[model samples]
Target chain A: MASLIAWRLVAAPHPASLEDYPRPPAPAALRLTTLGDPRAGALFWMLWLQTFDDQAGVTASFKKMDFAHLTAWLERILALDPGSEYPLLMATRVYGAVLDPGRQRLMIDFVGRAFRDAPERRWQWQALAAVQARHGLGDRQLALTLVEELEQRVPARQLPFWVRGLHVIILREGNEIEAAKRLMELMARDGGLTERQRQAVEMWRERLEELR
Target chain B: MHHSRQHRGQAPSRLSAVAILAVLTLRMALRERLARAMALMIALCWAATWFLASLLVSDETGPQAAMLGFLLRLGSVFLTIVTVTFSLTRDLQNRGLEMMLALPYPRGVIWLGKGVGFSLIASLLAILDVLALLPLAPPGQALLWGVAINAELWLMATLAMLLSLALRQAPLALTMTVALYLLGRSMHSLLLIARQSAEIAAEHWSAVVAQQLLTVISWLLPDLERFTVTDWLLHHGGSLTALAPILTETALYLALLIAVGHLELRRRAF
Candidate 1:
């Protein structure tokens, strides 16, 4: 999972140019267009381009290339598409994976900007909540707001059970254990929790008691 | 003339039987809203793939790969829920068992026929969904082979239906079905947990029993996770070679469940 997260982060369209990197022969004739979906096809190519550039930067950090040249490459890519969702989401996701306090703040800013621009997008709301939870933003106030908004917008019957699970997680993180417990009970009443989920909840309850 | 009329009113001819069964299953499936729900689910999955694809940057190596991974993991779970709730539950509610028994056909034959019919429907849906997802997948033959992986999920649904018939309670049946799904997905993790727990608390019999139970359930239930080829499809561009073995195992499991269901139905007062 950690490696996967790193791959996504490094693959984001950095503002860096690929020319600084030593051009290795393309490994295969495979191109993204053959994969299908023009949108995804474009994204795949962009990811490859960014990955090559990022690797060049790493090499520069190791004194394989001029640091200024690598920096210029990064700046160029960033300049080309500063507002793209791909980089912002990838950066935020990678930031979450690393759990770095400073990087997390940067991720939150990116997600916030994305959300402000596209408030209707569920991904933006979810990403914002995730970052907010990690950063303890507004003491999880942002997380709560996003959850509430999602609940109101998403139909109760059609909502995925994971969303409700997220709400429970938020409540638990906010020191609302009793409320979380009550919510679980309500879900049980509504036949939402499967037998295993209920069992897992029981285990959680026991662990909570030990903590208390 | 009376004797000829009696023969005419008897069981349907083979051609008519096939046509009637096809129409009945399709019409009933549509009327119960299952068809609409499945269509909506497919649409949502396509939308999700598009959204995820759009998030990939030009320089990323694994964004498309990761999105595909996420979709398959999430899609498998959703498919299990939908299959069990919609297909299996509808059969139970509509007295499908009674209808089957009422027919002059052998009980086992009826069970096998219904199972095949439901499996076909599920497979068709799975194939359509995979085609819809093709555009978002990484370039490979493995991506195309991922279509067959959905058969495992359908097998689980068939098993769930048989179990529900045996249990005769929707809530309990649904709970068990979902539990089976979770167990199938997390079997390896649960086994590791059990092994670790056993070493830490060897004296606790309850813990030992829990571990044993989990291990048993993992093996007893269909391991739907084994059919997951999305990782290989998106990353390595390799076909799922385990398709034949998995299909055989699923068929065998379905046979056993249906046999058990047949026995239960045979003994049922109604």
Candidate 2:
């Protein structure tokens, strides 16, 4: 019993959260290292990235995170399981929520590239990212660029009118009233919108006129 | 004419002996708490899967399905290896094998009985695993995953029995079985790495030799990567055509292990 007590005192373990972010291996190398089960491997790392701070019962501050290194991991994970939206969701919601403007911009840019890969499927994250840029980072230019890219890559007909008119709203926010009115006019002329969408567009046009 | 009739009568009795021994093997395992252990493990695995599912950000069930499939398959393989090997090695350590050999049944019947008994246990585990998966995965995909898990566990069980009998020590035999399984699972990835490295450094003869050695080893070992794929549960239901090679490799390997085990058993003077 004395020996056991002595051993316990000496072996008192201090568990610490992982604070340092390491760059992830290339996708091909990671696939090889995981014994070729890319799906499981990708998921394991994604979970690790998601819960790394609280792993040892300690919460590492988000400011401690190296967004560049973290972005690399997200990219590699998405490369491994391209169909998965978990990584992008993390980038837009969790990492993008960091108070550091530079890190927030980093996540927004990562979401932009990821969105380009599968525009139809990943447009939601891109949309969230644009909102983050405009509101969170207060970078209107970055927000406008993202909205333009989303408009170009995803077809206006495929999107609901409200989503299609995101750029017009951004333009109005930037005080480009003439451009916003012109774009809204063009959107109202389209015949493909649902009754609900057309009504939403009319509301937006009236609001823009009131603002002007 | 009298000799021929005697032989005919003995054949049926010998076959019956194998069947009886198989039943006895299963009963012994049950008495050793195999069922209870398997149930506990399954419950724990499912609970963990449920907890992890809530943490996933994706709206689709693919990640959850993949996780359940992976956990169940891994747990079954680990449990089968430990149970089969430890049971056989215990019999060997306690001189139970000698007592059994003193019985009237031939040595070959004893080996077949134990092998089939382990295979039956594997089937039960597979069925339970698939049932656990049904909530997360489509039924058709779950069934395919179940079949592959069964085949993979069958291979593990047979290999465990053979190694335990040959080595007659639980620790050594278990280690060897696990090592072989890990090698088989990673052989495809190892081969790819070797190929890439060799191509990158063509002037290095060591890389070429390493690649060739891995190729030969891969051919000798079962390609375990083809079995129990999580992708099958995540995507479209797996086709029967894809299962063909896995089943074939399992059957062929089981035959080879049985033949080798039989010869080893017969040659030993116990």
Candidate 3:
């Protein structure tokens, strides 16, 4: 199964590029390193995959990685092949971190393509929702719709603390602080507060009180 | 190992650990000039807090701000360095840790007992400092909240000790702890940089690597900034509603640090 996945990743055609994509120039050292390496192709793919893994596990797992290092890895992977599954996943996760609307839109389009190819994957849906929300796309109606669908399909018992927390954020961002507070209180009562979740709830509560 | 179920006399093992910790603290209080140094530093910090508070006047910022500002400026670095250095270098230097390990009690107990003892002493100093700044602080819950924030500082001190044990080098452990402190404080900024860089230079290998490393560092370090409620308490005259969560997370982080320290310490041949 792993081999098949690897093969599919390697054999997959390059993903279509967004027009006027603002690709930052590659670092001189990285470009030089890749140019001389015989196995640069495979190295690039692996680096791309590692970047996605880092993002996936960022909150609770990848605590030792610094921002500069993560960016460098993503850039290196993308430099080798922009269309790889690894870079696509990394772009989706990175969207939440970026503030620029244009950059976020590019990531969203990439995610949209990934979803079209793999419609059944829930993560792609979640990524698209996040990117769309960040970009203020479609009156945010589409993002809300995706979240609503996700909430229904993701059983309360099975949902990760972060995913659940994201729903609370959605509520608060939508000016539903009271509802968000209530939801956070419920989560705390149910012992669902991961360290980060608890901190987020506290921050949200403080904001709500300040507004009040 | 003798297992004494009933104490016909004093429990020597327990008494011994307590005695050791007391002696250690006393010696530290004396040798490192901790007594006189801490006293002077605390007084200076209190004066600074007073000055800052006077400038704010009747503003909500008073007790918590004074306490937290003083601690961050003075207590955190001082207490952390002292605790971590004593826990790591002093023990190995004097071979005191080896003797303690030879005792009947579990090594974990000894490590924790020492941490608790150091934390208690640090907390006492912190309380005194906060009390000194009370005159400049706003009335109401500020003092109470200030004490709570001090407790968080002591908790971090205990955590530093565990890291000292794990790393087994005073300087390196102190460096790492401080680095973690900085990382936790600048988490939002770090995340921003990672995301922005990734988007702008998606094709740049170096940028990608940089972002990945930042993510890892963010996850590994305990976010000390979250416990910094003194500002809110002082400036806004408000208490954190997330006290329960904060306490829970601190406990988990402390436990994990101690557990990892124990594993590392146990593997040493000496």
Top candidate, metric lDDT: 2
Tens digits of lDDT, candidate 2, B114-159: 8888898899999999998888888888898899999999999999
Q: What local lDDT score does residue A113 receive in model 3, on the 0 to 100 scale?
A: 45
| Candidate that beats the other on lDDT, 1 or 3, i.e. the better one | 3
Q: What local lDDT does model 3 show for residue A158? A: 59
Candidate numbers sorted by TM-score from highest down? 2, 1, 3
Task: Write down the lDDT of every candidate, Cα atoms only.
Answer: 0.56, 0.85, 0.57
Tens-digit lDDT track for model 2 on A42-72?
7878888898767465778888878889989
| True-structure RMSD for candidate 1 | 25.9
lDDT of 3 by residue, B1-270 (tens): 335535465455775676676567656655766667667776676565555445321344433353445344346456645655665577877898788778777777777667666766666666665565555555444455455556566666766776677677888777877666655655645655577777889648888888888888878765554554444333443455645666676778777766777777777766
Q: What is the lDDT of residue A96 in candidate 3?
A: 31
Lowest lDDT block of 10, candidate 2 chain B: B4-13
Each model's DockQ score: 0.03, 0.48, 0.01
Error of 1 at B269 (Å): 2.6
CA deviation > 4 Å runs, candidate 2: A1-18, A25-29, A32-36, A55-58, A155-162, A175-192, A205-212, B1-17, B50-62, B93-109, B199-203, B234-241, B266-269
Clashes of each: 16, 0, 47
Report clash pairs, candidate 2: none
